[model samples]
Target chain A: MSKTVIKVENLFKEYHLGNIGYGTLREDLSTWWAKVRGKEDPNSLIGHTKTITNKILESHFLALNDVSFEIKEGEAVGIVGKNGAGKSTLLKLLSRITYPTSGSIKVRGRISSLLEVGTGFHPELTGRENIYLNGAILGMKKYEIDKKIDEIIDFSGIEKFIDTPVKRYSSGMYVRLAFAVAAHLESDILILDEVLAVGDAEFQKKCLGKMDDVTRNQGRTILFVSHNMSAVQNLCSKGILLEKGAIQTQGSIDEIFETYNLNTHHQQCIKLDERIDRTGNGQLKFTNIQLINANNQIINSVLPNEKITIRVHFRINKVININNVKINICIDNFYGARIAVISTDNDVNFTTNFNNDFISRGYIDFTFPKINIIPGNYTIVLYSTVNNELSDWIKNDALTFSINEFDYYESGKTSANGHGYIFLDYKIK
Target chain B: MDNDEKWDLIIKPAGSLNFNLKELLHYKFLMYLFVKRDFVTYYKQTILGPLWYIIQPLLTTLVFTVIFGNIAKIPTDGIPTTVFYLIGITFWGLFSESMSSTSNIFVTNAQIFGKVYFPRLTVPIARITSNYIKFFIQLVLFFGFYFYFLFFTQYMKPNLYLLFVPLICIQFSIIAFGIGIIISSLTTKYRDLQFVVTFGVQLWMYATPVIYPLSNIPSKWLWVFIINPIAYPMELLKYAFTGQGIVNFTYLGISFGTSILLLIVGLFNFNKVEKDFMDRV
Candidate 1:
């Protein structure tokens, strides 16, 4: 049976906020007393997100809080989080690059972390020299390196310039050498911090192949932290979701992703741009478009091909040719992946309703009537066009959005692969 | 212990002072490689190359003789002024140079430290070893000048007590290393220490017997000089080479004891600072 290679317990890390915590002696003493008594931290609850951010005056913040998890031998764990979610901090702590404010990490074997690419390599030194230096840094003796030098060079595939100084090498070459050394380090545990982001697609594929081999052949435990969700889902068997220095969930890949899918909350950010703003010098500028269902409440979720009302209210700022006024609408997923686009250019006829009061400031409405896409979290981006050409673009984060699985197929069945992706089907003879 | 425990001993944080001897022994190959890099790279692209080693002390000795021997008309304890100043500068050079370079270990190698982890002390150990190569060259020149004076002039007397000079050199190195690592930790925060060290090390030579004889210091100043500790080992080193030292067992004992104390303090501070310096530095 596989033994536990790593065990972490109640690991807590705190940071000093300096004078920004806004407390005099009495308040500070009380806070300190509360901290000692393990009460709710007074400052921890006050970090509410706000609009009109005034120059980001944060003195200190907890990069990582009490994070605790364990991995058995040869287990590959993927740490996934948005920006500022403390994924890198967890990796740094595991790598021993920095000490925790309060925590202990116990591991049964040696750990080698590839936190960044081209780390510990001197530009003035040759690839050969860097390999030896990196080997020593990774706790390998010269004889050990002597045996593996060729293998590392072969893996890195920069042999033409192996004797050349590293400064001359491209960033890709640098990461290749660095990753080669790190992968060959032979530690029982390998910690990676999105190091694959530095390499090209082919090299990333090679590295993934190498990582797969490491886990399968050597039975090494691997911990990976990455922002790429697709890559994480593909590479890791287990997934850990972090949200603002705390773990939201950890479980099997599909289960955690599903929970992540269910739990991510949306505090909608509404913005008025030229595409959706009524202040422009045109016939009509879309200022606001709120999605409504049978219930007038904010449509928090929806299914694909559902009959949803997209109420786009706009007003004219000035009178003009009213020539070719177009509203371009694009629906995008969380990773900025555009799912679909709807535009007035596809309309058969252009309608012009002109009024002097409406020319100065009046409202026009556009109803999508129906949305045909798979179930997903999405935002609508709007752009304004005049004379069949774009005059301005407006970005609405969540305009008439929140899609669900109501997009119908001819067969009336979801694709075997999935329903949420690009679908192209034709009957064969 | 079995293989599982042996792997843990090295990969784990060190718990006691006994050291992971087997791991260090395994890493000896790295140590040797580092030392070779240091020794070879010094003269790699220089004009005079290794000749600069011998040329450095010879010219300094000549310049000092002109300043203190002829101009200042200072006494050299009845020894030749050339030999007197040469020995003083030699000992002072080794001790002070080692101190100055070792002091900036972390500051000079901050890039390397931020990037990866190895035995951080390995750099200093390599640096001290590199300085010895230069020291050996200077030793030969000192001997060359001594023999020349022995054959050509009337000032000639050898001392067998010089056999113990290597031990004194080793002691001076350890003391320098201890002090160096300590200053290295501080320089990580106060980078001004790096700038201060060059001038500080140069000024330190004046307090020791670099330009003057040990006898020139008044007996009343003995207690103050004894407390410094570097003064005695350096002065003893000069005496070992030139046979003109005021060799006292009490002074030697005090300096040796002080060196041991400094070494302990240095290692303790160095270990304490390694964890968080990547943030501050």
Candidate 2:
């Protein structure tokens, strides 16, 4: 077995909920008085319990609680978790961006992280200058940067504008250059946090290939944190699943992802209003979502050719006037790739009558006569917008449903599984 | 892969005060690049470019000449008003600019610091080095007018005390850098310090002999000005060229001692804060 490159032991990070700076002098003096008397801090008593009542004081929260794990040399470990699950905090601790509140992490060799691209990039600097600047920030030596300057430029595919300032380059070109510089970094351990979430599909593919080469050929360890399941499965052999600031499971990528999916799927039918993981203005909220058959029977599985209607109920808490109110529903496969997007804006006859009066309660229904999706489990994302601006509700994986195999033409021939997530209509003459 | 081999790094809740010489040496190239970036990017967008470096001190000297020399009637001893004020403001500008920028290191570079890990000390060191280049330019401009005064007239005489010029420059930079990092670390939690630093540097100049001669102050109250660390270097510079200011061993010793103490405290605070500043910055 290879040597253990990283060993984390009983890490716990506590964070205050409100202001991070030193409080008023009065509070400081009181705390000092309490300390002098050998009593507990007066303010520390706040938020001691986890009940989360309206009147209760919730002063602090644990970002990472008693998390421990070890990574061996040449291992690609994927950290999977939802937001606020301590994934970034763990990475930050490992990267030395922040100190763990209580714990020790022993790491071997030099580690470099691409937590963000173009970290020190100056817009006024040319592409070549930024590459050197970013490279140095990632801990590259001047000679090393010089050695790989040509390769980095070629990899970014922006050699034509290498001398031009990055301010003039398009955002795509900018990200490409930034990623190219970071991709060329030579380190014993490379830590990445959602770097593949940017750029086009082609560049993303190139990055994945580069990552593969870096680990497989160069024999370096990797710690990857991302929500993209397929990318995690494809790149990582080991996986760690985190939940509510604790490690829930650790195993092979396939096993851990299965556990993650099972855990999330259990919460699929819960009230949308109870989910605190949503973003928006809070003026409107999604209350409930369901998929129903033509007979108005709620179903979790349906045949490929069967008609289904997705009903989304919402509640408005404020009076507002909005034109061009749009509701967008996206269907994504298990790998977190959007397979289809259906929006009310695409409907020619659709009209939103939300004028000066408040909409107390309403529901939007999207009916599909023929679900041409292949037999697979998929997730639905709900979004609302007013005047083409994002409204008070956006939910990810709001609902999950599976399409069962069926022969649309009634020829007794079923679509083959694992071919793709979408089935096309065809006829052989 | 050897079990007995030492790990490259070990992170814990509290970091040690022992300086990591190996890591700093390893990141020497990064320091060079940071200095290069600062030097290149500061003037990239400006229309006047490097010309601003010369113009800034010249203009400031003109303002000082008008206000202190013409209106306030502060004596420059035997030295010409332009040379005296130019020398004072030029060196003072170097120290003040470096101090202000260094004080903002963590807050201004939070984006880079949050994302990547390098020897955090490299940033302030690079700031000091880059500002040295700017100071060097202004120094040359000061010499340009100094030589013009020497050749075109006989009002000023160069002296052997000019040998101490290099020492004075290093002393000023060290003191500024030391105080700057200390302020930078404190500003991480007490952001109100950011507002204080700008006006503080401006007010600090009055305590130092930037606009007036050290002899102009009453002898008994000279200790008050001597308590300001910058006073020694300013007086030393004026004494070097025009031979008109105080140059004593006691004041230099005190100045040196204060600078070294401030540097130790600054580096200690900076080292402590760099590990977890992202949480609050």
Candidate 3:
């Protein structure tokens, strides 16, 4: 059994919403007076719960609230969470980039974080110079960089442009060089945050291999944070699931993934209008989205070739005159790669209904008599545009549903095996 | 595990002012690399390259000579106007540039500082060290002019006080760095201080007698000039080169004491802010 290398206890971090300094001298004086009187800070709302309403009630944001965990030596722990789940804050605290508002962390050895690769790379500096600069920034000594410069160059595969300024290097080469330096850093504990999300598939595979070697062969403790479930399952032996500034569960990788999937897929209908994480002109908004079977019963698990209808209820806040208004819905697999796009542009009645003035609230029904897809969880991205130009609203991950494995071709075979993301109908001749 | 066993590192919200001297000493090579990066990248894309280092103070000296020497008729204590103002501007350039850049260390490098962990003091130290290269180049230019004036005219004079040049340089660096880090700590939350720093350093130059000799000030007002910490270093530089200007031991003592005080305050504040600056910055 390995000894514990990192121990974090009761960590909490709070952040002010706006300027750290009070906006006015009067506000500052008032706060100072409150402090002198031993009263609660006039500007702080530390214990208040945050609501998803339009009113911005609280000024203090709790980024991490009483989070605690321990990592043993040589344990590869994957931190998984949705956006705004405090994953980055936990990593930041561990790396000592920021301190917790309270609590403590004890470490037994040197730890380096590749929160972002090539963080301090100066664009004007040559690739070779940036290598030294980045290496030093990551706490590598001068002689260590000099000894490993050749290996870094060879691994990055940019020897021809080593002397060239990094500003001129293509973005692919840039990430390659940056990841190379970070991968070569010799430290007892390594922290990585979504670093493999960049580069092509082959490069990502190479990085995964390198990460595996670093943990399994070198016996280095690794803390990895990513939304890529498959990659996390491959590289991490343990897992931590963070939800809303708190750790929801911690266990083996499989157990954590199972808990995560169950928690995220519990909600069958998504109240899109209540979601705060969206971007658009705000003229139109998705009110609710639900997946229903042919019997009009709400469902979250559907088999391939089953008749399903996606009902997207929307509200037009303001009446606008537009000729070509269309809704685009894209289906993305669990890895966040788009599988297919279903748009209303091909429907002849889409433009006719939007031209009327009284159409403020309506539902757009997409009936897929025979859904074609593999067995996996999927998300939908819904967007509406006017005149094929300006986007009125766009909501990502508006709805999520899982596809149950089924033999659609009646051959007792499903695409859940070694096949790809889509199922094709076939016959043995 | 033994109860007395010590972990390699323990992180907390705040720490005492041991200054982490051992950690800093261990990462000395990183400091050197930061200094080298600053030097190399400062002139990376410029066409004139290192010539800009010479050109900056040279041009400033020329402009000051015409404005203060000829137009304003400022006295230089009988030394040639060119060499006197050159020495003043060169020394002052080292102090002021280091001070201003060091004061903005946290703001300018917030991106890198937020992403990685290192001794934050290394950045300010590296800046002061790298700037010495520019100061050295300008020093060579000053000496070239000094030799010309010494060989060609009788107005030039040399004295044993010239040996104090190294001490004066170190004193100047300590004072500037001390003040710089303090302002940097405050500016992380109150960005208005950044603007105040720019205007204050400019006004501070006028108060330090960079353009005129110390002798030009009347005796009754001498106390006002002596209180400014930079005035001591400026007067020392002038006395070493031209063999003129006041070299009062009492004034130097006051300046040195104040610098030490400022350094303690600066380091305490820097250490305090380094823990949580990312929260605000």
Q: Against the true two-chain complex, what DockQ does each candidate achieve?
A: 0.18, 0.69, 0.59
Highest-scoring model, DockQ: 2
**Superposed model 1: Cα runs more than 4 Å off:** A17-60, A261-263, A267-429, B1-26
lDDT of 1 by residue, A326-373 (tens): 766777675445777776666655444443443344343344445555
Ranking 1 against 3 by TM-score, winner? 3
Model 2 steric clash total: 0
What is candidate 1's local distance difference test score? 0.71
| lDDT digits (tens) for residues B1-281 of candidate 1 | 12233224222222224333575566666676677667656776589888988888889889999988999998888888888888877877788878987898877777766655566767787888888888988889888887887788776555776776888889889889998998998877667667887887877777776787678888887776787777877767666656677777798899899999999999878776766666556
Tens-place lDDT digits, model 3, residues A213-274:
98899899999988777778888999999988899999999999998777656543446777
Minimal lDDT window, size 10, model 2 chain A = A47-56
Each model's lDDT: 0.71, 0.84, 0.83
Candidate 1 RMSD computed on C-alpha atoms after optimal superposition onto the true structure: 10.3
Error of 3 at B212 (Å): 0.6
lDDT string, candidate 2, A326-363, tens digits: 77888988776678999877876665434334254477
- Scoring the B chain of model 3 against the true B chain gives a TM-score of 0.96
The best candidate in terms of lDDT: 2
Per-model tally of clashing residue pairs: 7, 0, 0
Candidate 3 chain A has its poorest 10 consecutive residues by lDDT at A48-57
Q: In model 1, how well does chain A match by TM-score?
A: 0.60
Evaluate model 1: give its TM-score.
0.72
